[model samples]
Target: MSAPSAPPLKLLPLILANAACMMAMNAFIALLAPLARTLALNEWQAGASVTVAGVLWFLLARPWGRLSDRWGRKRVIATGIAGFAAAYLALAAGIHWALLTLPGILAGFLLLLAGRGAIGAFYAAIPAAANAMIADRTPVERRAAAMATLGASSAIGLVLGPSLAGWLVGGGLVLPLYAMAGLAVVALIVAIYGLPGGDAPLAPRDATPVRMRDPRLRMPVVVALVAMGSVAIAQICVGFYAMDRWGLSREHAGRVAGYALTAVGVALIAAQVGVRRLQWPPHVLIRRGAVVAMLGFLVAGFTAAPWQLIASYFVMALGMGLVFPAFSAMAANAVAAHEQGTVAGTVSAAQGIGMVLGPLAGTLLYGIAPAVPFVVGALMLASIAFWVGTAREPAVARPADEAA
Candidate 1:
């Protein structure tokens, strides 16, 4: 007889919850400039507002993952979403008060920072729990597809969040922020009622804890660092590049950036959906995707036209879409079942580091030259592709005890 499979219903809540979380996160991101302007803050302060979240996410992801491992996936995820909703509401209130009756802009800025920090702290739990849950339910052979499904959901949310925010911000910035909070509340409800209550440990309760130094995890972790960093570099530099190269106004450049990012999101969704159906090994996917992305970046660096840049970004996005899910699957497979949360947290922390550094590096490079950041990003990705392509896949330990 065939082995029993995970019910389709079980995965739905995870997908929806992930989508909602990402949507809320990106909505805030989409409104950052406007938020800064409304509060009469400088560019540095505006940047710091967003940076606070990334910094907190980097510091707190591991602890949240470990907590989820001990407590339970559903509970942690639900609680996190609920907290995310509260944070969004708080952030909106901060902005509202700043506009209406705050003593000073600084007071509102501090409240906004606090709210963003809360979001980073609580939002960290969702991805770690969701990824660990996938690890718990999926077998090794099907893990990539499972991870891809989650990735697709996230991509959709990223796309929708900005679009929704852009539309709602026309009515008022506060409206969109509240809408994001509402979405989070809905996600919390779904997570509580729809997700499974119990999580069976991947290994026996007595299994040794997986160390971060495990050979199997090293390559994927490195890849995650480079991939996320490259993405961040590209993201941060694109708008500046558009303005400098195309001689567009800030408003026009912002719109161009949005269109380019939307192309990337569509490409990512398409590529991940396609890759999930294939049975390629993680290394193979990583190598090919990195090469494609590298090529795209190189092309983008040389492109003079707006359309050319957007098209190149789409190619890069397709490659990144494949790389992310493959790396996630490989990392999850590297350890015994019980170590999923740890590995997921580690991966999140790595990506968070990338987010923290990418902007700084990209901006510095952009000051040197318009195309320097893209060229550097391409070089980094090329090196990653070569490294991953040559590295040997480590043997994965089974979840079941050999002595049994």
Candidate 2:
């Protein structure tokens, strides 16, 4: 449990690993519109593939974190990247085969499901291990800002990934998938060579398991789930909404979605940078962000023009930028040092759960009415804002050293 001999961890490698994974994910997400068309899939069928992946992510994230505690952070990270690379390679090949062979819809959907599920099983390890590594190096008072730095890396990936995918999709839908696989391989090599060796440091007393239902984590976990669900709803529905609202073709809709998502990524980076500079208390960030995001979602639901929708997404990203890091930092601050991995994994698991349910609900809601999903997202954020702002802070949530 203790790691006296562990070398100092390099931040850049970890950043690259996290960024690469996120880029690949957002890239795939951004291209879902065109992907659905290419595969001749309905919204429900397309979303079900992601749901399967989320199921695995939710089930395994915490276990991966615990494995990091036992097997070492670097090992887990490398394993994750390796698996991601392999899965993505297979996915790209599958996409190519489907395009050429014109497989049956059920066969194609199942293939997509299997590939994504494999990626999810491995992808769960990266964030949990990476967050725990960051937590290992940071003090409680500075936790939010440190977490913001990590969030910023993912934001950078989000910005580039979709844009890259958008450009590449003109050539072929499988191009981005192949590119993602290559990136994952690079990240894998970095993980193998760039991270510190030895197991994650843990004091013997701090080695005890931290349950998800532990009182300290309860509010933070709830906040993570709701916030992630809101984001997921928008992500899943936005492409279809853009196509329907604008009367655009599949490829054009995918391009527009990419641009809008790029705005989101930029705003996320900008917000996280602000968090780094301002170093606000987690609750303040959560309350203000939730309120801002609520308004953004409302605007997105009502916006008529494609440009307006993109702007609305930017607004939403700005608020989410503050919320995501704050809640994770709050959870990290509340727990003992050894439980950092566990807490990080638990929070990720909550997000995974959101990914599962949110897309399913959003796709269904979109079928009912295009704007309904965003409306529901707005409602969820409104409740989160109300709860975070009004609820009494648990004493454990605020580290004693943190300024009120």
Candidate 3:
């Protein structure tokens, strides 16, 4: 007889862990301007401090995914959370000491970079393992829904983290960092005790390993890269765009940017929730989402007022909401069961690369024209929609609904 399937509640710990990690990252992001001011660093330096983490995450995500495949997912996740917590605490301490002692600014900046890079390195384990776990636990048809739950958790965290940081940063810059570190610790404890253990390879040893360059993976991977890069471009450019286009003060521009992102997060949650119920094929979702997102970006590029920009961004986010989970599910479905971690890693790496490139490209383009990045992003999405609409869907084997 086949084993019974695992309950959906089994996914809770991993989802919560993913939320905590996202919270830490977003909290730091919310404080970037303040951090730069506190360290007496220039804009480029402040940006570089944040960029180091994304770079490391891009470099290390695949290796961490492979490690999760070799080690158990739970163990890898727990260790990563603990390491992130420690690194966060150390970063806070280093910043506090530097501010008080007037250490050479370069030394303080390097310390911050090291800590951020460490967080990125360790935190890489969570997504690969969490995604692999979702694949392990869910049936083929339910994979998109499962991935949506994971995506929703991340969206919720993205909203909460920045909100908490904005509220707490009034007391001190370090307060939010410490709070995020505490949250990471809580996630670590939950991961160790609540998460299920022992992830044996799903595919047999004789099965061929999935590769990043595999033809089956190419379209989904490209979609992921372009979609994430578009997001990063918007994120990096929005505040500057608002200030330039609307003649807003720095503080006002930041508030406007925050509102725009909040809209994006809400749209993401709504889309994922709606998507899980529709039971549409991943390719269809990708194509439709890309079209919607492209229109949103196009509208954003031409907006004359702040509200219009925000609305355009919301529409764009709605499109992304459909696209992100579908792409993840598509990548997951493309691979053999044993290759889940590897594929997850590859997806994560693609996102990482996008994150790294998006900001650089967006900022450079912004120097030429405030609206250039948004238009460029829209075109990129247009291409993705066309590609996914035309590309042949990969053949994924659907197993009997046995215990995951």
Candidate that would win on lDDT: 2
Cα deviation in Å at residue 5, candidate 2? Answer: 12
- What's each prediction's TM-score? 0.88, 0.95, 0.89
Which residue pairs in model 1 clash with each other? none
Ten contiguous residues with the weakest lDDT in model 1 = 395-404
Quantify all predictions' global Cα lDDT against the true fold.
0.76, 0.85, 0.78
Cα RMSD (angstroms) for every candidate in the order listed: 3.3, 3.1, 3.5
Write one digit per residue (lDDT tens) for candidate 3, span 176-274.
888998999999988998898886354455655567777657766788889988998887777667777988765566566667776777888888888
lDDT of 1: 0.76
Candidate 2 local lDDT, 303-403, one digit each (tens): 88999999999999999999999999888887665677888899989988988988899999999988899899989988988888888766436432221
The TM-score leader among the candidates is: 2
**Rank ordering of all candidates by lDDT, starting from the highest:** 2, 3, 1
Backbone Cα, N, C clashes tallied per candidate? 0, 0, 0
Model 2's alpha-carbon lDDT is 0.85
